[model samples]
Target: MTDDRPQGTFVLLDLDGTLVASAPGIVASLRHALHTLGRPAPAEATLDWVVGPPLRRSFETLLGEGGDVEAALALYRASYEAEGMFLSVPYPGIEDTLSALSEAGHRLFLCTAKPLPHARRIMAHLGLDAAFEGLYGATFDDRFDDKATLIAHILDERGLSARDGCMVGDREHDVLAARRNGMTALGVTWGYGGAAELAESGATRLCQSTGDLAGDVAALLRSETGTRAPVA
Candidate 1:
């Protein structure tokens, strides 16, 4: 159910690993916390790959049950809170895509699993906070644990129509969330998730690159029924 229309489109983007190059900051902070917890941080590549998902899940695997989840989160937030958050840079061309979507009259929303304050801070730090009409982040305050629930909350709060919203993200979590909510998922290959995982997770489309996505979505700008996003 792809809609190739310029107007009446609601675009939900995953912040970290999808629209933002958040690896360095997340990796650095995780590394600092792991060592403090007497656990070895995962390989750099593994950590980079972990950027898109929730922090608790990442800690669960890297730190183990013997590891204290709350403490690990607190420690991770220490470095992240002070300086590690800015270590990341946005991928080139993301601003362009956001600008294009805005100009096309698309309603842009950010959907991320990053905790509220951290996610808002990153968006503000990277100048992406101004890009979206609204942003939805996971929070201990809200106790939102899953993408599907978060997304539903976003739509409900923003008064967005489900048939008009599409998710652009880099992970299976994003894909599954969209499916559960009866929306479309567009996998981004330029980010963390692999193709098979995205496809298996029920991604309706997989863009090869950010550049490719802008072009693919251009047609969607004018469509109502939706168009299939190019996967290759």
Candidate 2:
């Protein structure tokens, strides 16, 4: 059958939970920060929520009122830089999925809550940096921490229309941000968000596994008309 779906679709992918199993490193750094401050850190199992969101927001919660969030963040960054960032590895099938998408002519961009420099370094460490056309993310100064704003900034900077792009991630933040910017939201269950959170956030479609990601993304970017794709 002849394919009518658009080629060269702009895809924004999340870094932490979606592409890499980064919780181990992130939680450890967070623990280091808290421990440095003499604050008790939560158990690893309970800190999965910290993997995808902005660190400042997570630290704010971790530190509570009158807590030194800046100090905690500094310590966390120090730890992440020294060792924690190297602790992660990309998800299984992720490399193949990326290769398939790139070979099919899709343009991929890394859009994450992780700081831009760190995101780049991590991708380089994983040898996946070459797959992306650009890596856009948060800054220590708070710029682009909001997913919606980050998506908007990406659209503007790249001169790409919302109709030609899709945001792929494993979180409600990713889905909601895509919808807010009039783009399709493609959620992957293998990531930290799982099926429930993505569904609740009204994802255009959900890929139960990385095996289906490239196909789902291609289909969504092709037929979507700058409106939210029907939940599937």
Question: How high is the lDDT of residue 174 in model 2?
Answer: 94
| lDDT tens digits by residue: candidate 2, 50-163 | 989899999899888999999999999999999999999999999999998888788999999899999999999999989999999999898999999999899999999887
- TM-score for each candidate, following the candidate numbering: 0.89, 0.94
RMSD of each: 4.4, 2.6
**lDDT for each residue of candidate 1 in 35-87, tens digit (9 for 90 to 100):** 89888777777666668778888888877768798888889899998988888
**Residue 161 error for model 1, in Å?**
1.8
- lDDT (CA) per prediction: 0.79, 0.89
Model 1 TM: 0.89
Lowest lDDT block of 10, candidate 1: 223-232
Model 2: CA > 4 A from native: 1-5, 224-232
At residue 76, candidate 1 shows an lDDT of: 89
Worst 10 residues of 2 by lDDT: 223-232
